[model samples]
Target: MLVRLALAALSLHAVTAAPAPQGATTWYAVSTTPQGDTVSPPTHWYAVDTSSTTTPSSRTTSSSTVASSTSSSASSSSSSAPASSTAIVSSKKGVGYNDEYLTRELAISWAYNWKSRRGGELSEGVTYEPMLWGRNATGWATDAQLGLDEGASALLHLNEPDIWSQSAMNVTEGIDSWLTNMSPFYGKTNLVSAAVSNSPEAANLRWLQYFFGNCTQCEQETHAVALHWYSDSFNTSAFKTWFTDAYELLQKPIWITEFGVQRFTSSSNVTQKQEFLEDVIPWMEAQPFIERYAAFGTFPGRFVNDDGSLTALGRTYSETV
Candidate 1:
């Protein structure tokens, strides 16, 4: 049976699902964290599942109802039509873990034994969303190694591409080089989005433009761009206005990679989180260019970790998306 399964694995199967009722649309939330990790909060992803069995039918004409008088020998023939396609909507969820530990485990489990473990099968039918924090040599190496091993897909979070004090143009060049070198092994990589904010160097329009201009390589590589928006820096209207304007300027599909209301002195209360989501998500979704959306940090704390988990925020994300 195993041998037979292996033999049949490469064959592509046609998949279809019922058309969304009237104006309804379906979006999938693919989780980005590892299968079983407790510390890191789960990252919810929205991906279009291109593989399914439910097919939509076309309208058919009724044969002449009054064909009783003639020979009365009628036959019906069926025609096969092309399948309909659906769009994938995905978001990022962050689970905390020492980066090295997660990457090492992933390499061992997914890459070496992928073929036997049905990686090809999984790849064919479902869109896997993996999140990568683009920082440091070790993290980048780990991400590349894991991709080679598991045959996994990713939405790389390149928030601060240059931890060192490199210019935005130089940083983009470096990223382009790194991705180019890694491509042979990784195949077609999908960069969900990238950002460069909260840095002293990246504080001006010239820097932002340079950073985005560098992202031209990413677009050429078919990677989508994610722009980060922070509430602390800008008010709701201002934030939306800036992003909308930027999207127009960039002329590429953008995802709100990270947006949240942070309470530094006290823990994040449910009210603040709820208000933030209620105000932001709908307005952002209304835009046509924004492809996907993700909230920053699943728990209440910062990226480095702190006390208290905003369970309410987590629940709200799951419920709303």
Candidate 2:
């Protein structure tokens, strides 16, 4: 009965459905008001499931196959991998949270926020990469550019543009904004393409295909494919399927910026998410194409509680090798 994926209270069984409806614009975002104020939207289910917990599944992988990386893309020797100093750590493990304390407690290697600024007391040792979350990444360049000089090797580009609720941009709009806001970093750093949702719907995953097809030079600017996955399924194989598809489609390094279970039922529990993490985290770490990753746990419900105590799911994720 040990469970883990994201929601521990629920069954550890792998989920088969996307947590949210396809094309749903209900995901979270960092938006800007007309008055130039940065806005934090409601976290809702997307932050981390507040209703349940998951176990680290004792580190068993249930997937039939991870996306088979091509002979060339899977292990092709590239420039020596970036040193540990890069904003996205070479360890390829991280947590999505604003609290420096949680990151320190978990001892994860890197961190990221929706915007480009490195938030509060995050240690200098924990490489912090910046993201241009939405279309209006106002003033993101000046701050993120500094990473170049600081040896930050990666820049997370637009958020989920396919989902109207996230970045909400069409292919043309997304590329235009990327060229304007992200192109400058093309050679200086690894530009992670827009992170799209893991939903099987055509729009969610196809967005990247459309983007790369249209922008002939975009592949040069993009060092890796930024990806995300959210579901209620307990099947670890499903996670692998998603990863395989993305890898085969893009044939580039993959950075799993966000991936977790969204507990929508009373059965959700930490063991489920724990199992999910145990299966996926280790798999991701071993994969050569999976350059980096961070579980989605911005609020207390995920890695820790409101009192700042590590939850069952958190314990597994932190202790995971």
Candidate 3:
């Protein structure tokens, strides 16, 4: 069952954005403050975007800092702790597939290369679920084949359920059966998570419910609700509202799987991105039910400029998260 984003334009050109430089870095980690208060400054640490930067020198480092006051701004509230259980972190350390570079052929190629590179098997505890678009039979087969090789789990993306009418129930059922048959070898059955169309499109929620409700297997097997909440269109309050609503309605754990602010194109500067992340992290960390939050495009090549540098938002994400 290939899950896809119904609203994302699916042209050959649109799907495969140019790959970033081989040595670019995308993700970096930072230490949390001891008191679990706000992020302390002198937060200048940065890493190359791994998706783009392939240079040998572009490995993780603890260098870099920005000067700021250390005085404690104490608050009475207790800080939240990180989520205890999550899908096993992949033993293969690096970025997974790039959404912008997704295609049926490319996805197949990636599965082959990824499986081979990771010792021709999935990491013992890690799950590998790539996003699939459309009713792509070949792609689904490829995913099952890769699962056989890697022993990884998967999550199918149902981009648009409204298009999958009752008339197509037979086809959907067949796909469901195929997925179930593949599950024993793959370690776990793949779950389905729908993409929410832009906020103005109120019908997307109905479409999501309809699709999930119709698939008995998916309803029973699905573990998490995934969403891509872009910081650009949503302010802090709006995101909080959405998170709260999703928690109340879904009952399943929520993963803000893909999220980021576009600092390169917007009038909002990098400081805004940093501030936004700084503000959001504590709030998200505090949420008891929320699972992991992965920022969009941690690779420098995906979002940064040609000079091999960090975008303001990228820097902030690295520093704060």
Candidate 4:
């Protein structure tokens, strides 16, 4: 098997079902807790199995039909095409694990076949985009050099340049660095802008706009917008607005490199956190302009556990993909 999906071995306590009224057979659905504990939820076997089988077959048929339709549509001129003919295409879901050494393993735990940084593949379907953090690293290759050496599908630049604890490059320094180092990779590979914090000034949306407005060369070179959002707000409206606006303003495909409901208060509700994941994930997946999204925190409440078992959020993410 290629191991394209995250498979976790949870500690399950199976309870024998009650003798099903003599002649009846039943099936049960397994549910996991946020702590990675597994439990069997009551399920009607026939309904569950029938629905599962039918859904996949129907989706396969639909996918085939859509592929054919898209091919036929591509042959027509853009001006002649119908406005409502375009369908929403989903981008791949990825993991944003902070550990460089556990890149492949964390990717597996989260069912992420795509990574943000380059590394050895843990399985057959893995792919990645190389990153250039900052000027402090030793023996770091420039973006252009890395692109030539690795042949990446895309290249990521700067971690969080607006935050002092991360890349810490001021606006002037960021522009200067981009012009000198990052600009060389312009035509060689898909150039992604430096990911900025949600902070004010040029670090977030403002910083991205500033970069494009000031640096003609940088603007011309940019191919995608990289964004990061961490918030306690569980609602999707706020995120949707920010995301859609970024795309409309920048006129570039957006990559939500990092996004999650971070615990901002001591009263942060677990239910609300899970709600955020359930709602926001599907919303992002439906956006055609969103090229990719990486969920922050693969360990504990974020998704996976220390022993490699998947948390509730992790399971939701895996199933969503």
Task: Give lDDT: candidate 1, residue 158.
Answer: 39
Candidate with the greatest lDDT versus the true structure: 2
Per-residue lDDT over 13-49 for candidate 3, one digit per residue giving the tens place of the 0 to 100 score = 0111334223433322222121111112223322222
TM-score of each: 0.48, 0.72, 0.50, 0.62
- lDDT tens digits, residues 202-275, model 1? 33222334444444444455344555554343257776766655554554556555555534113445566666
TM-score of 4: 0.62
Give the Cα error of residue 152 in candidate 2, in Å.
Answer: 2.2
Rank by TM-score, descending? Answer: 2, 4, 3, 1
Kindly list the per-residue Cα lDDT of model 2 for residues 1-321, writing each as its tens digit.
001223434432222244543343333222221111332333322321111222111112323333343223342212222232222233567766754334445546677766677766555456788888776776888888876566566888877665443555667777788888889778777789988876543255566776776676776688888888877667888888778667766767788887877652233576777877888877876676687888876455677666655667776776665
Q: How accurate locally, in lDDT, is each candidate?
A: 0.36, 0.62, 0.38, 0.51
Point out where model 1 deviates above 4 Å.
Answer: 1-157, 162-169, 172-187, 198-208, 211-218, 300-310
Per-structure clash totals for the candidates: 14, 50, 28, 1
What RMSD does each model have against the real structure?
Answer: 21.2, 10.8, 19.3, 20.4
